[model samples]
Target chain A: MDQEVINSYIPLFKDAFLLTVKIGWLGIALAFLLGIVCAFILYFKIPVAKTVVRCYVELFRNTPLLVQLFFIYYGLPAVGISISAEVCGVVGLGLLGGSYMTESIRSGLEAIPVIQTESALSLGMTNGQLFKNVILPQAFTISVPGIVANVIFLLKETSVFSAISLMDLMFTAKDLIGLYYNTMESLFLLVIFYVIMLLPVSLAGTFIEKKVRFKMFGD
Target chain B: MEPVLKIEHLNKKFDDFTVLEDINLSIAKGEVVVIVGSSGCGKSTLLRCINGLEDINDGRVLLDGETVNPGSRNLTKSREKIGMVFQSYDLFPHKTILENAILAPMKVQKRSRKEAVEEAMQLLDRVGLASRKDSYPRQLSGGQKQRVAIVRALMMNPEVLLFDEVTAALDPEMVREVLDVILDLAKQKRTMLIVTHEMSFAKAIADRILFLDGGRIIEDSDPKEFFTSPKTERAERFLRTFEYEK
Candidate 1:
């Protein structure tokens, strides 16, 4: 590609990178909230929720994310449920991230012994207090690294939304390619944009994993 | 004197497995009752039922003048009057010893942080762990954790305290320290029910000792008579194993 062309595309790539981050941030925030609620439901085994949660987890986790995204974006709107493609993308990613987050949080919850819950109950703590004060803090600390990794993964996964014309990093790259007919330059720019946007998050995930492991396992 | 606790026909089952069956016992006000039994004989379960930690399938658990019901949604409120220490100590690993000790009083009793910490410091001092108040459970020794747990339970100012083999997890040398603390509390006439395997400690401290086997109270008597003349073969055999340990 020409140096002049590459220089002009840098600004476009920056815009795409920012859009990717916006989608990732919103997706992760929603995922985190849903993950915590699902984790609690699974942890306490509320009513018939254990089986229902198990089915939900298995269904989402076993299926491909592309199919889920397609179903939400293409299938839902046909039935008069007309959510924006951007909202659909964020919600789809959030639900997907929540599936992974639920497993992470549940593992964290399992690492805490049942004796802790019993002790909390014996102390006469309200159920709300027990969940808020005793369980959530420990579970969050234990799940932090996994949740961070999920967020990073979800950041990369945001590229899938481009398939539905969300104007994310990949979508903008495609638009640039169509305009200039320079597929190589646009493709290379897209790769660079994703790498630049995600490298810090990847490093952050690794750093947090190390810190949590150190705190959990000692020195 | 009115009975402080009364257990009549106390039965518990986990699916088809019976943990306790036909347990009828009573403790008078200020009396110390020590339950000595083999593992899986339901001594701990019995104490748990009394404190509303475990629900009995069919039975009556009366604490003071009121009937204790674990089935009720408001059982936690009722549990404020009863405190329990587990064998594993079960201190909240995330909390410091002082925080663990004061949490119940502050949350359940609505005591001020200053008041709760003041009470906790006194209990810590009583348990010989005033210096370790800032330490987490993971930082403390097993014996120290159990002592802190005992102090934590006592901070609730419970009418009845249950110890489910609290010293069983400690080292042999450390066992005496926990026992000494319990003995001191007993001297203060704190209404206590201890589920213990340490026969010597039971023989020394129990105002009355109950020997359990196969989920039934085979023998209930004072330490002197209970040790000297066990009526049931199961109690005799159970006590015989401790003779070699001593």
Candidate 2:
């Protein structure tokens, strides 16, 4: 509620918010793409790719993303492979998100009944027609809620990038507070920034869930 | 006459568990054959094998005198010729009733949307489900869904249709309504292989009844003959049990 203190840090906050948006958006998009590819690779049981994705999902899901961040940002530089903090943040989040995303997508695809698939097959549908008409529509219904939840989680998780000096909203808030000693006011702005970015995403999740259900069941 | 559909010495097994043992059958162009059996008698497996859904350990399924391979890359040509309706009324929950009916023709037959819709509508109208064509599956009753499933199969203009316990999942009252639609199809002389427990419907529609037991057909004869005087002791015992249960 301290306008005098908050107003001074607004310019820095804006840059951090923009950076958060850029990295979070790119990170989530990358995760989604990777998740889809991994899920399909498992679904089709592609020889080498399936095994690779399985091991990747297992490795990432079992560990903490924070440790992964340190390993990528701190540990990679030891081997002469230096990367920007922003790239490290995105890579860490993307791998973590993609691992969970694979499970969500895989389960969503698995929830499609064999009967529905067999019905489409018996109708003489080619692989393309079957996917477009049956599999994709059903998979979307199963995957949407999980995906939206992941997106919001990723938005909040962008704060973790501050450890790598990525200058996200959390880092900006920390800097302003350390200099001005306004802990509550600075943290309040960070919370508002996240809610602004994420509320619509949660709403979109419910909207898509209802629409897909209605299309499938008419209720 | 060359059989429209034939199963020659079809032996199907899953691991060490045998489902069908040296099964052989043939259906003429307009024959209505009913397969009746106790539970676990491989009747449904036989139907699935004919549709190439179940890969037989031995023997081949011939549709129009050509062997249908389950593992073939492009089996659509054979699949489009042999239609199947399941006990669960496996209509696409996402599509409307008409869309379910038209999917095969539009995709496999490569017919234009208008042509497919036109033919699909006629089939739906014939089954008394024309008004429900635009409706989703959940909006309909079990009987209505089963009828829609029948129309969906018929839309392909398949050479033969397989009904694998279509009424097994319906309530008692709903069963008759679904069976009545099949009765109409029977009157039209559509070639069909039916596996059912509804004895009266079988008696009414079947030109021949094949009684299966222990993964073997114990008796294959005219419906009147099979019911009146079952040839095997096992067939007679099966009828006796069903009669006692009723």
Candidate 3:
């Protein structure tokens, strides 16, 4: 644990941390959007689209993020489709996270009692209005815990972004260890930065879960 | 005067088991009709069928001379004219009582928030829940929640209101408060079709009492006549059970 080595590594780790946060959040955002859309598709049981979304969820959930990244970055290039490494990392993470999100959200949607739907419809709500106003709000509240978990899982999954040459936090740590061989300092900073990324997310998640539960279920 | 709602030869079945059969009835505007029966006699199913909540095997439901086609775009428009409150007091658990009351008016009827909230406040106040407008459903007693459910249905100002066992799920003490709200509506001549096991409440609130047995209307008469001297033996036997329980 050399003080000089640790101080020198700070700038590199800072840049890597910023890159990880940016890509991780973007991927998580994409995952949430994809998850909600796919969940609704399955919830409504739309004919062909439901099967397609099911297959997409299964395909992504079953495969590793590393393989998906490799396929997007290296395998697709074989077919003359070239996506940059940043895009590859974000897309790979989003595709993988989307599957988990779909299941999480789908369960939330299902947890709503049948009476809610009946109550909404009986109030003269169209299918769209009922879903948007009544179903989605309750379903989202029910989904907060699962969604927060997904966000954290997706953020941690960003560690594999190095496979696509994204220069994320993991890449910087690995590069520093290879060059300086300061295994202790590099690894320590890596753990610190990763914790810095994940701790707030988990804490924020718990806070939100509590707040929503209180709002929904009351004191 | 034309009826506000008319059910003609309605038949509903699940797979092969018949739930509602050959049900035909008409409700005039401002009439309070209470349908009472033994458990599993299709009272709730009849109300669900009237609201287009249950898919009918055959026959049609007409509101103001327009047909309601279940699972069609027409049904959505038609549903706005018909309000229903359920046994479960299905107030959105995540929403405040105010939000639960105003959601359909603001979203479905495209009313402004100011107007919806104003109307919601008035209704909530009428139901003695004005102070709890900001409270979630879980915070309220079962009786209070049911009152909120009633307010939510009334916000839509439907041509006809259907209550499917609204008070059946409430505590014995909570039952009167909810029934009083319906009685108030009955006094206002709000068209309502209620299904309840509360025989005395039915006698007090109903202009007409429908006695259903085995998925058919066995008696449709004035409340006094039906209660004191039921025409059908089945009605006599049904009323006897309530007496037996009492």
Candidate 4:
């Protein structure tokens, strides 16, 4: 309820919000790329790569993002491989998000009826053409909801970046609370900023799901 | 005249059970052959084998004198010339009718979009579905979707057309619309191998009737002769089943 405290924290929250958005989006983009590739590898059952991707998915999915980030940020330096806090945050989030993405996309790919493949093949589509024109588009449309959820999940996971000295929104809020004992104002701004970050993505996801379903089914 | 499609000793098995056994057949150019029997008679499997959809356990299929190998690179090329319309009217649900029709022509045949679309529109118009070209598959009735499927197959200008119970899934009234389309194609002397339980439609459209029973061609004779005086007792019994319905 302190107007002065809230106003004073605005500039700091702004900087943190921008940083969070930057790293969060970068991580999500990387996650999407990794997810698609890994999903295809598993879907097609490509020889050794399938086993490798399966292990990768299991490993990342079972471990918490917090733990993964800890390893990348804190444990890597002992092995003589040091990365910037920003790089560590992005890489950790990307790896974690990618596993969930792979499952989401793999489910989408599997949900496509076998008849679809037979139809495409009967039409004389080469394997590559079938995958590109027929399979990928349908699978992607089917996975939109899951992919969006992963996006939001990965963005929230960026909060843990504070542990590695990244000045993200959560770090900013906690720092303010600890230094100035302004817990109420800081926590209020944190909640507002998080909502600002997630609300549009959630709405966009629902809009896209509806639009795609209508386009596909014409209802 | 050489045969457009030839199957020699074609055998298909799923583990221990044999689906098709030693099926030898040939289809001439511009011929209309209708294969009819009870369900599980391998009629659909025969069409699938000709199109290289299923891997045969023995024997080979030849289209235009070239082998149709299921696992070979030439399978795609062979499939381009063999158009198949399924019972479910397997039109791509995501695409509009026009897109579904024009896809194979554009992507597989490498035809220009304008050319493919132009051909597709004409074919759709032929099937009385030109007005519904922009509609998705789910928006159309079963018959309309089958018509679109027919247009999609015709867009390839294939050497042979295979109809695997194309009207079996349609409503009683809708069956006529799809059958009429096939009957029209028959008038054009298009080479087609159709598998259907519609005995009357089969008799009307078929130049030759192939009655399959237990994975073997029990009878292959002129439609008039086969309809009137079936040689085999099984064919007599199969025809008797249809008579009871009438």
In terms of DockQ, which candidate is strongest? 3
> What does candidate 3's lDDT look like per residue over A1-219, in tens digits?
999999999999999999999999989889989998999899999999999999999999999899989988999889999988888888888899999999999999999898888888888887788788888888888998899989998999999898778898899999998997999999999999999999998999989888988978654
List, residue by residue over B133-243, the lDDT tens digit for candidate 3.
Answer: 998888899999999989988898888998889888889999999999999999998999999999999999999999888888888999999989999988898888877
Q: After aligning candidate 2 to the native by TM-score, how far in Å is the CA of A7 from where it should be?
A: 1.9
Give interface RMSD, per candidate: 1.9, 1.2, 1.0, 1.1
Residue B165, candidate 2: alpha-carbon lDDT: 99
The candidate 1 chain B region of ten consecutive residues with least summed lDDT is B237-246
**Candidate-wise lDDT, in order:** 0.85, 0.88, 0.90, 0.91
Candidate 4, residues B12-32, lDDT tens digits: the string is: 998888989999999999999
On the 0 to 100 scale, the lDDT of residue A207 in model 1 is: 79
Candidate whose lDDT is highest: 4
Shift of residue B208 alpha carbon in model 4, Å:
1.1
Question: What are the clashing pairs of model 4?
Answer: none
TM-score of 1: 0.91
DockQ of candidate 2 (2 decimals):
0.72
TM-score of each model's B chain?
A: 0.96, 0.96, 0.97, 0.98
lDDT order, best first, reads: 4, 3, 2, 1
**Model 4 misplaced regions, further than 4 Å:** none
lDDT of 1 by residue, B42-147 (tens): 8888888887878789978887767887877657876887888998869877778999998888877889999999989988998889999887778888899899
> Candidate 2 lDDT, tens digit per residue, B1-246?
999998889898989998899888889998999999999999998998887787889998899988886886547778888889998878888788988888778877888999989988887888788998889988899999999998888888889999999999999999998899898888899999999999999999999999998788878899999999888988888888767542
lDDT, candidate 1, residue A174? 84
